[model samples]
Target: MRHLTVFDLDGTLVDTPRAIVETFTAAFGALGIAPPDASAIRATIGLPLGQAFGALLGLPADDELVASGVRRYQIHFKEIILPRAPELMFPGVTEGLDELRGLGITLAVATSKVHASADALLRSAGLRDLFALVVGADQVAHPKPHPESGRLILRTLGVPAESAVMVGDTVHDLHMARAAGMRSIAVTYGVHGPRELAEARPTWIADTFDDVVGLLRAAPKGLAG
Candidate 1:
């Protein structure tokens, strides 16, 4: 049986906090509004861009100001973040992905970024071709913690919920997996701590990217469940 492993982009496969933080700062600055502190911004890493800005600015996600901020953030991200893509990836990610592919596990991405931006970042990082599909917030009716993106990926890949696993670093990812009836692996090396991730009840918790590889290797049958 074939297995599918869907990953969250920002914190799972790539360490994008610096670029994200910088872009947020720049966006707020452009709007003449003070940006949230780096830690506060980092905590919102896996959320949709507008939602993150909404939380930071204390406005609704669809507020006009928040919309403007999101647009600015995207502009800054392209100018400042995409160029740093290759260096932003975490260690062991490339090797682990290659190993998983060798094991014949299909890979896909479900991220909070807009579809175009996510695709651009992956292509810049040289990881785009590794994934069979890349689903982003714009492509779905709802974003993370809603399960629409996860369900979309499974449907697009022709994989059953039980035969796929969602690997990510946030409660949003975990909750999405649960709502979609897929297993989850939460990595502690990202924005969330073990305690926070544990609340989401992930199937496995990984301290490093290599542990993710090991978990899958030890659970070939589990992947098919």
Candidate 2:
């Protein structure tokens, strides 16, 4: 069977906290509301835009204020964040991805970002072509920690859950992988710290992007459990 690897975009493949923080701050300022502190915003990095805004503003996800915030965030993201895509890639990401492909392992992305934004960011960073599929929050009825995104990727890619591993930087990603009956590799360099990630019970914990590549290369098939 062909091995498959599903990755989380933000905090995993891309270092997006700075851009995300700036965009959220800009959006809240546009709404004349004080933005959440950077740490609070960072805590919500792996969630969908509505959920992130809701958590930050203490509003319901479907509230008009949250909707407005989402709109403003998108505008600022496109104007400010997208332009900096090239600088957002994590170290060793490009080389590691190339090495994974060279190993003949299929790769896909499951991100909380909206489909259009995820696609645009990856394309702008020149990493879009590396993925066989990119499933974003908008493409799923429920997002991470719910297993919808992982299941969607597996089903769409025709890869069994056991033949794949989910690599990410947040509890949401690890939980999603477990819920989907797939093994997970948690990277320590992202949103959540090692202690928090350990609570998620990933199959392995990697300290860097190169570590993730090494784990996959060392046990391309066995890592899936």
Candidate 3:
């Protein structure tokens, strides 16, 4: 049986940390607040938009301030992030995925980013057709750490979670995969890094998307569908 390879967008598939920082800075500046600390904002990369906004702005997730923060962020990211998205696709991501696709593995992209933006970025990066399933924060009823997105992606691919691997850069990804009863591969070269990702105890921990392919290759057979 072919296994599934489910990926997280943003930190895992694209290196948007620098672009995110720029956008967030634009957001805060647009709001006339002292620009947020870059490291703090970057650390919040993998989280859902509301949570990331709230945390960055020190507002409750449902607070009005959060709305404002989101508006500010959207104003900039929607316009700038896509074009100048940080080119952090590591050294081996595209080629790796291409090779994996040639292996007849099922691939999907699950992201905290909105569907439109995720699709655009993937296309802009020349990776549009690589995924059979594209699940985004807006496409699901719930976000990461809530299994819904992962479950949805697996359902779309007609694959059981047990036969899939979720590769991401955060605990949130691990949590969602675990909730969906799938194995998780943590990539450390993103926002969370290795230290923060250790708590998840991923099935494998790789340092780059390039390195992740080797890890998947080494994974038990029938795991990278």
Which residue pairs show collisions in model 2? none
Q: Candidate 1 residues 23-123, lDDT tens each? A: 99999999999888999999889999888999998989999999999999999999998999999899999999999999999999999999999999999
Segments in model 3 whose C-alpha atoms lie over 4 Å from true places: 220-225
Model 2 off-target regions past 4 Å? 223-225
Which scores better on lDDT, 2 or 3?
2
Candidate ranking under TM-score, highest first, comes to: 2, 1, 3
Q: lDDT of each prediction vs. the true structure?
A: 0.93, 0.93, 0.82
Q: Give each model a TM-score.
A: 0.97, 0.97, 0.92
Model 3: per-residue lDDT, tens digit, 1-225? 777889988878888878888888887787788877888888788777788888877778899877887778777776876765436566788899997887777889888887877888888777879889888898888898899999998887788877889999889999999899899899887778687788887888988776788767766474534
RMSD of each: 1.0, 1.0, 2.1
Q: What is the lDDT for 128 in model 2? A: 98
Q: Give the per-residue Cα lDDT of candidate 1 at 31.
A: 99
